[model samples]
Target: MTTEPFLAPVTTPAERREWILRLLTGTQRVDRIRRLRESIILSLLFLSALISVATTIGIIYTLSIETFHFFQRVSLIDFLTDTQWTPLFTEKHFGIWPLLTATLLVSAIAMLVALPLGLLAAIGLSEYASPRLASIVKPILEILAGVPTVVYGYFALLFVTPLLKRFIPQLEVFNALSAGLVMGIMILPLVASLSEDAMRAVPQSLREGAYALGATKLEVVWRVVVPSSLSGIVAASILAISRAIGETMIVAIAMGQVPRLTLNPLVAMETMTAYIVQVSLGDTPHGSLEYQTIFAVGTALFLITMVLNLLSYRFLQRFREVYE
Candidate 1:
């Protein structure tokens, strides 16, 4: 066998330290890094902040410009006062009410479906379930939230509508009921997760105190835990309401494109976002007043959602307690 070249033995700690120092002092890489001595950390943070600020400014500026154009053609009164909507036709009428009605109708339906189911789920997760069971179920419930809205829309349009047509034949292909119901399912995880957290935050001492006073489990939960967590529940509900209002894709697909003043759930109706989508998807000229209508509708939606979210945040802040 051929012998390899003999290497020198390792040095003592002090000798090794000296060697490392000499090497590092002469290193070109370190010298280069030292040369560009500007605060790279600060530059990165400032750049990130600049991007965020720029994005906000761009959105606001674009929306404001188009909304101004739209308002010049359609008066504020015409936009707000008129109840009838015929945007795409020869008889062009601008009305906020029909869109508002469609949005509210779907939102009301979503709330109705989400509230009770979410509350029950929250109660189960926080109060009734074992730790092992909760671990299994919570992630499963979250999967429902993870499903894409467009998929939910398809399920609503294809499955739910056909099923409903079996009983209520008058139920239109793209009615508010299917859209609202699917929206509720889409929003279920939001309500359930938040409400569960709020319910879980209630102290065990409160439940024990109620039980010590000869209260049943049902009574303890209803009187003590639920009441103490009332603010949180309300906050969660408001948050869910905010989501219901802003939901776009599901509404656009499952709800019809028709902009109608009718209150009937069976009739086809268009939401504000849906109206924007309908207009933008059409072949209207880019600079025309008609194209600008999208931004005006968007501004209206933004105002509504912003108000709702602000209210929710206020509720959460006011109602939150120091559990300690």
Candidate 2:
């Protein structure tokens, strides 16, 4: 290729100055085009975001306003303080505790089962498993996620409940424990997959250096991999918790429509989603406060899940440290 400068033919000082000015102007024009494109793209994204936020806030606002009207008729103090939650009766008691307790109990059981098992699986996949083992096992783990939740609900109701009854006679046929345990299994892929990604991203040189210093595989994993991936592990746990909280069909079918204010997982309980399903399945009157109750429960559930996500993000920010 010819190596002569493009400006070589412009030998005169005047020509050089003109050429330089032309190049500078051309560069400025290109910069302007790039800036305009960036601004347009970003503005479109920002506009989309504003619409999303407005829609979300509008729903919350509409629900809150209607809920306030409901409270005026139903009494906020009683709703907050009372234990019973029968909203469709002549007596019309509407406490938030039963729903809250049910959601809490199911989520707690799910977390109890999912956390340790998923984390261990992630550890094995990232730290100990051979390539052949991973190739065989990863798909197997993911299969759990692919199973339809309705099918799990069916199994929980027919198979699991009966099986549990054989061992524990007092266990309810439809209980929080069965629902939570199944929900945990359902969300296992979320925790294991994300945590494995995080662990794999840890610097290989860190492991190599540890091994060079006479560290065993266990020591390297415990000290380096787990610590480095702590933020991601925590985030996975939080996400698993979120999934457990939001699961619908499994809890709806397996967990009975009994919104008890008890912590005992052996007893039947109804989650927020389950109660919503129960209420809607009955085809309750559209304009009734009972119909609007789902939206209120939904708003509360939304806030709780959002808080958990925010907390997870904060943990991610604090623990992530990458070095050159």
Which numbered prediction scores highest in TM-score against the true structure?
1
Clashing pairs in model 2?
Answer: none
The estimated TM-scores of all candidates read 0.85, 0.81
List clash counts for every candidate, in order. 0, 0
lDDT of each model, Cα atoms only? 0.86, 0.85
Alpha carbon lDDT of residue 139, candidate 1? 91
Give per-residue lDDT, candidate 2, residue 253. Answer: 97
Candidate 2 lDDT over residue span 1-324, tens digit each: 876887579999999999899999999999999999999999999999899889988978987876666766777677778898887678877888998889988888888888888999999998899978987898899999999999999988888888888988999888987888888888888889888878887889999999999999999999988988888899889978878888899999999988779999898888888988998889778768887788777777888888888888887665565522
* Model 1 regions more than 4 Å off: 1-40, 46-54, 319-321
Per-residue lDDT tens digits for candidate 1, residues 1-324, read 665533233267887787778788878677777766556767887899899889878888898999998888899998999987776778888888899999999999999999989988888888889978988999999999899888988999999999999999999999999999989988888888988888888888889998899999789878888888888888889999989998888889989898888778886899988888788788999878778878888888888887888888887775675453
Error of 1 at 270 (Å): 0.8
